[model samples]
Target chain A: MSHMFRLLETGFNPAVFNMGLDEALLRSVAQGESHPTLRFYGWKPPAVSIGYFQGLHEEIDTDACAAQGVDIVRRITGGGAVFHHYEVTYSIVVPLAHPLARENILDSYRLFLGGIIKGLATLGIPSEFSPINDISTGGKKISGNAQTRKLGCILQHGTILLDVEVDQMFSLLKVPLEKARGKLIADIKSRVTSVKHCLPSAGSEPFESLFSTTVGALEKGFAKSLDLDLQRSEPTLKELEIAAELAAGKFASAAWTALR
Target chain B: MKLELIGKPEGCKLLRLTIEIDATAGLSAMALIQSISIRGDFFAIPEEEFDALERALAGVALGKLGLEFSKLARERGLQCAGISGEGLDEIVHRHLATLNERN
Candidate 1:
């Protein structure tokens, strides 16, 4: 059976709503209620999302988050903490029966990440897929991806850094003094570079423009690679309701956040 | 059995560990010993102690070490399971070897 691809771009939503949408899409696809979908979203007021296995108390300063009105969320996937600022986040949901979905986790990462690598390449940035799940330029990570498989559906989501505040990110996380003393922090700083830093000479492309270009490139890549016609559509009322329910029940709840 | 100290003042850490007891002790008994207390300053604690604790717990048969570690970390006021249960022993042993090499 031929698969249909739909791209839904929900620009700059609050953290709660964005997470809700991801869960909603995952459920919809899993239940055969919706076709395979790719979503591009951003966080308004900004936030930090930690992996499911992470500890918020240890990985994040709750006081700082509250003071800054930054929402703290936990994704269903596993990975390190990521500060969502000046970046474009993308999520792809596919039924497990899909040919691409049958691949192993790392293979799935490569499949989805191909779009991201191509996206960056189109913008004159030379990026390559690093082992596990990062897209980097000259050893500096510009994108990190994570995934969750449930109910025969696969959901992969990740961030593309447009500009990064390394200091702010460092301050928000807990780094042991000993590890901080060595080249660890320096190593991380050296290894992770943002698109803004890479394009310092571009003179004047706003973050939104860059994000749009990246998303456009990804859409084109998916269409060509999957051999499918793509459509951009708004979420159905049922999907929006499901997302809100998921946000209230899972993503935005203390029970989910406090689960270790 | 091995005992090690880690972390620094204010965040100092302590780990009371027992590991690789004879198989006669049974997996549960070895697990109980591996479940030894761990608490102290975050900085004063030696890396070896953490490695030892992870290895000892990971050695427990039947994969009960994950649940035990989870309970132990909570009691010790630590957040998150530092060690993963997937390939528990192998992963822990690999991590310990790495720490040993670094030290």
Candidate 2:
């Protein structure tokens, strides 16, 4: 008997909907309601998701989010605020006893980051996995990841930058104004690079094209590394229902928004 | 009365502290004073010296004794600064006032 892996490429869903789907998939996997899966998703409305331990009032400008119609949500995992835009996000859920699960947290991050590194290589972007789970190009961060484990399963998700509005991000975040001024802000800008920044001559690839290319590369890399075929599929009915429930009860709630 | 230092020794230019209210108020009634700036004109010091300084300062309570130690650091040419965090002073004072409630 061989393990089955499914690749769900749900492109450009609303932030709440995508978070709901990830939770739903994790639940189904834990309950044995669905097979272990890898899901690639994107945000349509463009939002900032803070880590579970992060304080919304401390990390985000709620007024700015509301005024811009950006959905503010908390992730199940732990990390700082991630501005999700012009990026490809991946979520992987696997049983706790799986080989990948036996590895230490950093080891597991490296394993998944390996696939991402390979994917970026295919796009002519030579990348390296930095300590503490960030992918960088020439010392500038291009991606960030976070993970959570529950009920015999682990869900890891990460973001790859294609293009980002650095100035807008600085404005919307709650970082100290002094930190965002002059040299400090310029230092941060220098340390964070986008794919568009890397490929100035190409005039930035279309989002759809970038999505397809990156997903195809990731699927191929994972298949090669795991020695398994990644069958493309959609969420089962039960998974969809569970995701809807999580979205309504948790991801879309004020309690969750205000949680630290 | 004693104080416990809790923070990384490096990357901490000024020590920010929080004094939580608890029943063991008198047992931990020390004001925390941090180095405003490390003096001696050395970029880094020996780990053993740093650790010794930390251990020596661990349980010193606030008062004349604490002020005397700060003066000594200045005389020894060590630069340091400190400030309390939000609600820390209020919490500490509240705990001290309620010491009678703790039997």
Q: Best candidate, DockQ-wise?
A: 1
Q: Write the per-residue lDDT of candidate 2 for residues A100-216, one digit (tens) a residue.
A: 564356677787778788777777788998856689998788988877666768788888887878887876776533333422445666768877777674356687787677777
TM-score of 2: 0.71
Best by lDDT: 1
Q: Each model's RMSD to truth, in Å?
A: 9.1, 12.1
Per-model C-alpha lDDT, please? 0.67, 0.65
The interface RMSD values of the models, given in order, are 11.7, 15.4
TM-score, candidate number 1: 0.74
Docking class of 1: incorrect
C-alpha positional error of residue A217 in candidate 2 after TM-score superposition, expressed in Å:
2.2
Q: Give lDDT: candidate 1, residue B78.
A: 36
DockQ for candidate 2, please give it: 0.04
Model 1 residue B24 lDDT score: 52
Q: Residue by residue across A1-260, what tens digits does model 1's lDDT show?
A: 44578889988887878889998898888888888998899998789887665556757888887877878888777666788978889999988788767446667878888877777777678888875667889867899887777677888899988888888877676655543443245555665777778887543788788778767877776666555567788777899999888888888899888654
